[model samples]
Target chain A: MLDLSTIREGDSLPTVVKPPISRSTLALFAGGSGDHNPIHIDIDYAKQAGFDDVFAHGMLSMAYLGQLLTNWAPQQALRSYSVRFRAITHIGDEISCSGRVSEVFQENDEPRVRIELTAANQNGDVKLIGEAVIAVY
Target chain B: MIDRSNIGKSFPPYAVEVENHQLRLFAKAIGETNEVYTDEKAAAAQGYSALPAPPTFGFSLSLSKPNVFEAYEALGIDLSRLLHGEQKFDYIAPIHVGDVITLHEKITDIFEKPEKRLEFIVIQTSLVNQHNEHVGEMTNTLVIKN
Candidate 1:
């Protein structure tokens, strides 16, 4: 649990590194998310779509960022979260989800934290950029 | 060009039950070792009624709607050329396992940037629990390359 009393602007969140994605990971995600797009599961179809190989679903990476946020704070604290997919995540890419407190202020007499989030691969290529707002005590 | 006439149109609302096993699978897929996400006993110890749906779990629930592709087909979009551009979630309350949440989705907007060779179709979705309370709203932007 996050200690709202001690959190400060510019404080960095603990980084969460994901295991290297494999074909089975995407298939499991597809089963869970119900996103059975062939480009994500079929290498032949992905190549037909002019890609080198199958790619990870963008929402999967976003979910990793969500994991990062919820780990730091309670689920009830999350007010808003948004992410823009920046680049494709290939099947073997390892994503690292990280964030930092950008600002803290009062909204309607309640404390709120605005955080900037990023999911990047081992090669230092960013896959998604996002921002999240949460209500804190 | 996307069929702009579909803007403001809403799809049929559907209900999804948040299941613990699916939540555990998702947590595992994300490499989340947090017991509260996968263990009911741990979650109860943490003061939650049940294993809470991991953040973004709503996306999975929302997409599970059977009529999902019908929304894109309405706009004359070819599934092959579709790409996810962005996604946003507004969490108003905690959604837990066994909650029967209903998902309502609509085609909110459509725009194009000819110079960039892209067209965007934005869909806004809302989730309400059986209690008639708002759980969250999701904005999903899909891009079509020219």
Candidate 2:
């Protein structure tokens, strides 16, 4: 069981090996995730649509947060996790993922925590907004 | 004009079986090496049948449910502007390799906000394993720019 008191609101998770977003990495994510949407793999198509280059899938970015949460509270069970895509991520962009504990409450007499998560580039622009609910025994 | 009727209808069930290699590849892509997701022996120690699929694994198979996004063309949806809004999973039991899952989905809710012209729909997809035990559930939202 996870104790919310041990994790402050702004506690940060360990950063993984991340570099400038690339077309190849994006394609790998698409293939592995089975999301073959062209907007994430075709640079020309993305450029024609007003993007500088192919972008990463929003779900790929959000799923990264799952790694973060699982790393922090390995014992807690996930109830739900959701994120809204805010902006497009283009190739060569370095993404930073972060999360903050938002609320702690009880549901059906079980302890739960809500976290607000986000991933952004150095430009101070957000790429995704995520929220998750986890249950801790 | 779109065939509005289909917008709220769900097609027949489709089956999506868990594949160990797929889960392995997905875990590798994210640099994850958790025993629960990588080692069958370790997973069994934790009481799981096999390396349980990760949370978003549903997206890998959830789309297989019949008639997913079939009416988009009729509604003039560019297919290009479509984006995944959010995904939620409710686990009745963990998903493991060799589990043959049959998905039955239904359009549970639909809403259109005037300003956004965005269509919000919820599909509740049930997953039943080879042994016929319910393994997991998936709910997803797909957004299209109108």
**Model 1 lDDT per residue over A34-129, tens place:** 788889999899888888899999999998898898778877788899999999999889999999999998887888999999999999999999
lDDT score for candidate 2 against the true structure: 0.71
Worst 10 residues of 2 chain A by lDDT: A9-18
Give the Cα error of residue B126 in candidate 1, in Å: 1.1
Q: List the residue pairs that clash in candidate 2.
A: none
lDDT per residue as tens, model 1, B69-114: 7767767887777899999998888889989999998889999999
Q: Give TM-scores for every candidate, taking all chains together and pairing residue i with residue i.
A: 0.96, 0.84
In Å, residue A47's CA in model 2 sits off its true spot by 4.3
True contacts kept of 2: 0.43
Worst 10 residues of 2 chain B by lDDT: B63-72
Q: Which ten-residue region of model 1 chain A has the weakest summed lDDT?
A: A69-78
Model 1 quality (TM-score): 0.96
